[model samples]
Target: MKFVCYTDWNQLPESANALFLQAEKDSLFFSRPWFENVATALNDDETMALACVVAGSKVMAILPLMKSAGNIGYALKHRYTPLYSLLLAKDDQQQVLACLVEGLHQLPLEALLLEPVADKDGHLEGLQGSMQAAGFGCDRLFRFYNWFLRVQGQSYAEYMAARPAKLRNTISRKKRKLEREHGYDIHLFSGDDVPHKMPDYYAVYSASWKANEQYAGFVDTMVARFSKAGWSRLAILYIKEQPVAAQLWFVGHGKASIFRLAYDKAWKPYSPGSILTSFLMEYVIDTDKVEEIDFLTGNDAYKQDWMSDRRERFALSCVKSVKPAGWYERFVASLKRILKKQ
Candidate 1:
């Protein structure tokens, strides 16, 4: 395997993108455009690099890393981005992962901080084993659940009937109330409609309780990119042709992610946000034929009601270079030994 480290995103060849597209699974975060957008948002505060493994003309794997003090952080850092992984071809996952770890071992860094890695169907097992074998220390920082809904071959009514009666009742009542009192309508803005409808989308967002935040700039910058790439989903709930709530999603690889959402606090009583979400869920499953819907990152109380199945996400710290164990590391290791003795 040939390992190449790239300090410039623009230097990556077009062929590299084609290789990623052909991978068994695509990680939205690991995509070249996503990395570029993130790097653009970060400015020069942090450095970025792409470490890729290639065999002759084919690229097998790639890791987009950000440089911080002495550690290499994941390319994107945000709450909405809960899951991350190396982009590796399906057939060469093991070899590519192991090779990537070996390359990391040669880098001069304190540790590689990878977070919110999916616990199921992830490379944690191979990653941890390779890091340990390379004389590195590996530890799981924490774990959290990411809720998702699988779109089985069932209609929206069939799926809705399976939900709890109380949830079903609440959704139906709120939906009807909004329609009856306010004449609400849901509009989907994707493809060409994204850029045109963004002003309306932002208007509702500005009226939301989460308005005027620092992340707005980043969202604005990235939304255009996502939209142009054909993955943006902006669904707005309108009352009298004015926006009240919006659900921002990113669709790719047959999966749709619930990226951001908000509603006008004035509509709080109407529960327009919840109504919009429910409507979009049906639209994606019954209309767009998406295979899955990911309620990314958070395990809010309401998410549990919406999604019965979940996948765990984990944070991992792998020390690439073996130094004398720090006091904290040694203490934690010893405590584990003592606890096991019990």
Candidate 2:
């Protein structure tokens, strides 16, 4: 295998095509167009992309990367995309992963920080071995707990029964409230139906944030990229003609991701977010379209209520330079060693 690193995307243009195609054919996480679309949204400094391929062949796996000054390795994205991103590829995941580590070693940077890695095995194990053999037992962070509902093998009712207790009760009661208290219509954006509803979607998302004093332009960014890449959809629940709850979902391959959501402030008492999540799961399970539904972040109470499974996603930190932060990092290491001796 050869690791081909390029400073520019156009430098080895065919490489991306071959690698992306291979990812589409094999790997679920790598198949989504919006993965790259979202990664491109995070390019604050120099963006570096790498592809690992058989020496004389097309491509095997690719690594999309971005370089910042110190203590940060980006998933190579533009400012508009999500913070957690890496390249999307299918075959030879470990090869692509090792290539990224090796390629980072080539640069004269301080440290390598890959935040929000999606597939834990594809990189974590192989990269950990490589880093340790080189005399570095780098830090791994369990920053966020990922939530996912397994909708592939069971019916909605069956899936509900498998859950603990309170969740099943909530789903049953919420569905009843949605049907009885007021007539609720659930609308989802699909295919060409997206454009007409984009503005309304943005209003609900932004307003939801404004009420809490936290703002995320990520909603608008997600809409445009998902639409451009043709890899996303939105589901909204309306009560009496006003949009009360909205769930924004993007599908890439057999895995569908529910990343962001919003709801009217007036209906917080009704638990709009929870209801929307439950309904979305029902929709996916009923259609049998996606095998896994990823909440993608947060160890919050809501995730436990919605998802049947949990996977902790970790960030890999490999220290490179002996500069300023490196000094503090060394001090931290010394502290750890002293603590161990005690």
Q: Candidate 1, residues 1-342: lDDT per residue as tens digits?
A: 777777786777656877556532355665666666777665466777787877777777777777755444454455456567776666677777778877877777656766667665455677678778887777764457889888777677877888788888888899888778768778898876787787787888789998454677677777887788788889998889889998888887877889888898998988888788888888877877777788877778888777768877766677544455474486445434433442
> Candidates' lDDT values, in order?
0.73, 0.61
Model 2 lDDT per residue over 1-342, tens place: 666766565565565675565554333345345454454455365556543434455555455667655544545443322224344355666666566566556656555555555545544456656655554446766555777777757877787777768767776677787678777888888655665676666667666744541334444554665566665678888888888777777775666777668887777766677777777777777763777777766778867766778877655566653445457478446434433442
Clashes, model 2: 9
For each candidate in turn, the TM-score is 0.88, 0.76
The best candidate by lDDT is 1
As a whole number from 0 to 100, the lDDT of residue 181 in candidate 2 is 78
Best-fitting candidate, measured by TM-score? 1
